[model samples]
Target: MGVKSDIINFPVSSCLSPTDKSLEFDRDFRIRHYAGDVVYSVVGFIDKNKDTLFQDFKRLLYNSSNPVLKCMWPEGKLRINEVTKRPLTAATLFKNSMIMLVENLACKEPYYVRCIKPNEVKSPLLFEQERCRHQVEYLGLLENVRVRRAGFAYRQTYPRFLQRYLPHINHS
Candidate 1:
């Protein structure tokens, strides 16, 4: 607070003027976003801003005897003192989980098969050879099969494959 010009709090913007004399928004602050400027009251979340609320929730859920919650909040296994200097936000946690899921699935070598309807009108017992053949030709299913057969080996993106299995190799 003693550092010169190191402002502790933002000053009320000159652009923000209250319409009613009875109302006062002294504690509120104006934030400039790409869409527009908006006023926010810091009164409610000031204390919450400093606390590791999500981390606490993760730890609480981790302590539960239920297997599902313990599985979801893996970081909860870490003691309160072991958490990083800044707690990771919910979005960060979600992103990390998604990355891991993608990496794990990439190792499975799943193939995409597009099922084409026999006809447009939902008629049963209809076999459209021309339509099915056209789809297979255009979708390069034949070429894919030829290449796969020629190679006769599992193929995956190297970086993702390495990242997925590296931990297992190191640990074992």
Candidate 2:
């Protein structure tokens, strides 16, 4: 099979005239068209040339003094101002939160639970050898076994270890 070549055509200009009521001209003669959404940008609708539309949108959404926005979400407006004041990206916020979580976990006695999928078919007795091997390797069970065989895999001070394991055994 072979494809046929055909020329595609597009309109050279918009159908609406400058005097059309749908289009409005500001003091600077910048055209602002009224789409279904009341939101306006300095850039024209078709071209969307404004680079700072996101920032402008954010400002509109989080305008603390805007009566409609304040009425719609009082708490959101307050929080938005706090969030906008800080120059933090989503990645930075996520990294900071993860670091806090890790620090918190380090200070506490952590527990790990390992889960394995027995088989793809969901049969109780079906033990797939290859799948089990892959899971074991991925979970580092082999490394854990090697560490245990060599020596203590984990270390802690005698007093701290004793305190953790045997609460009744006073160090006095």
Candidate 3:
């Protein structure tokens, strides 16, 4: 029998980093909890798929220097608040982005998404109390979906790459 091509074999682009203008004072990255008032502008649609959620996800997956994107793994569970009405698991977020792809591809059904540690890219600046504050406020730390068995150790396709770029974690 001949091997068949995967229907989901979509080419991905590079993940988009936040612009300097977008970076908020005192934030590491721009993230709003589900309870937050902000709409959290995930690009719904962009023709040819550029800048859209699907492309962003695909790029975030492939372009990362981190190893997690190269393979798949099981992630822990999450629970929704019901009040905020948002997903508790990072997989849920991934699945939603995939759904956008599927729907755009004219597929009626949703595909399952599994969570791995979120890609932990650097915050894009050296630590300065003031500059870093704006950067932090603009971009709070992204959550780590995959936690290592040991509290200090981390698991993913890659290890410690993000930490390499981040400012020294103050142990004091």
Candidate 4:
């Protein structure tokens, strides 16, 4: 085997829609395509030149402005993101998929990436109340606590890249 790239930086330039919206909450690992301007560096493939992990099912969020990458699980969607105008629900990116994964890296533990809007009071100002800052804070805390039990080392890293690239998802 060739020496793996010690470090790689991938810039997510685009994102995909979905082959079928209803298929979003169906499977843990779905096939996707990386149709974007930038590319990713994946490891342990027969053809590293064309290997990529971004073209797969990921966790879905309630509302998302920036793209949130997730690890599809047997259970229902288990991911979250900030509120956005497009209002992304339990859906997956099918076309224009722009995600990347780095080889051999460590990332933060998984936590209850929840929907901030759920905790808010229904009102005309709901837009201003997208994600409750406090809720996310607690989610972070709970994630740390779970990580402790799972023996996942606590590290400060961005959620997107870490989730996509980590060899193993550090469950919290």
Candidate 5:
């Protein structure tokens, strides 16, 4: 906490954190992310951060009889007269949700189910080999396969190799 720098390093993932330099010098700040360092302009920062999603749409979705739709847009519950504070922006809500999810998953062994889209067309029974192959490569499924195949863990589908399971089969 004693460390001092022009840039305030913290959880930049959740919000647009203005560095000390940006605040003091009235200029843009550079964010060092996992991908790369990106310089973000402070021009119209306030306007851009404002929630742009329409209240009518929010109310429409919130008033939906479906519980899922209603639950999704809690901001819609506000009446024209009862409006006070600005509801969370879509980005803020998403960031908060992700933070909560990470907190919940921190103590648990996370299990992931990676889904690959078979085709761009979203057509059923249409398996796009190239698309699937690309997804497999991108997701490092090959690495997963290699890891699983380590230390004499060879996969076999041959006859006369059922000796280990024969006792169980005979018992059954």
Candidate 6:
């Protein structure tokens, strides 16, 4: 017998301030991870920040520099873009990236999966009807059914539909 365990990993960025030798913006990083855990605790931090620690991380990638930031990224000697006037901070960039991802997902089809706990004591044979009903109601399955019956349950392109079923059909 094998035990099934779900592990969630969150990528946290920490920046060391050279002046005081203390972590900068540690609380904000922890808070962001906590909030993200609430939404995707089962999915394992799907929206982890890419490079959101030091102020000059993005600049280092682009080979740009600031006099103060140069100590942190010595090789990033290229001049910052003058047209933009101000570069986006790590927090702002993370927020914008999340917004863009949400917007993109909003334009695509969505799939939902529901997981239910069997019993309070983790008994395999126990099926509690009231608990199941409460789970269903909390998940809004009834509302989904009503809305789906009122409208098209699924919409697919003609070519996609043909591609899916053509192989299964006998072409007489």
Pick the lDDT winner.
Answer: 1
Question: What tens-digit string does per-residue lDDT give for candidate 5 at 1-172?
Answer: 4111212343344444455443323345566642346776656543465565667788998999999778667778889777655655655554455555667778676566888889888999899998888788877788887987784555554454586566667453
**Ranking of all candidate structures by their lDDT, best first:** 1, 5, 6, 2, 3, 4
lDDT comparing candidate 5 with the true structure? 0.64
lDDT of 2 by residue, 10-97 (tens): 1223444566564443312233322112424333332232232233344555566777554433224344445454443333333444
Residue 116: error of model 1 in Å? 16
Judge candidate 6 against the unseen true structure and give its global Cα lDDT, from 0 to 1: 0.52
Clashing pairs in 1: none
lDDT (Cα, tens digit) per residue for candidate 4, span 57-112: 33332223343322322121433343232432222232122222222123434554
* lDDT per residue as tens, model 3, 29-57: 34453224342332332222332223334
The lDDT, on a scale of 0 to 1, for candidate 4 is: 0.38
Off by over 4 Å in 4: 1-115, 119-144, 149-151, 156-172
Top TM-score: which candidate number?
5
> Native-vs-model 1 lDDT?
0.66
Name the 10 consecutive residues with the lowest summed lDDT in model 6: 1-10
Tell me the alpha-carbon RMSD of every candidate. Answer: 17.0, 23.4, 21.3, 20.5, 12.4, 18.5
Q: What lDDT, from 0 to 1, does candidate 3 have?
A: 0.38
Cα lDDT computed for each candidate against the true fold: 0.66, 0.51, 0.38, 0.38, 0.64, 0.52
Model 4: residue 14 alpha-carbon error in angstroms? 20
Question: Candidate 3 or 6, higher TM-score?
Answer: 6
Candidate 6 local lDDT, 103-161, one digit each (tens)? 78888878777777756887999998888787777777889899899896777878999
Name model 6 segments beyond 4 Å from true.
1-52, 55-90, 146-152, 157-172
TM-score, every prediction: 0.33, 0.37, 0.16, 0.16, 0.40, 0.37
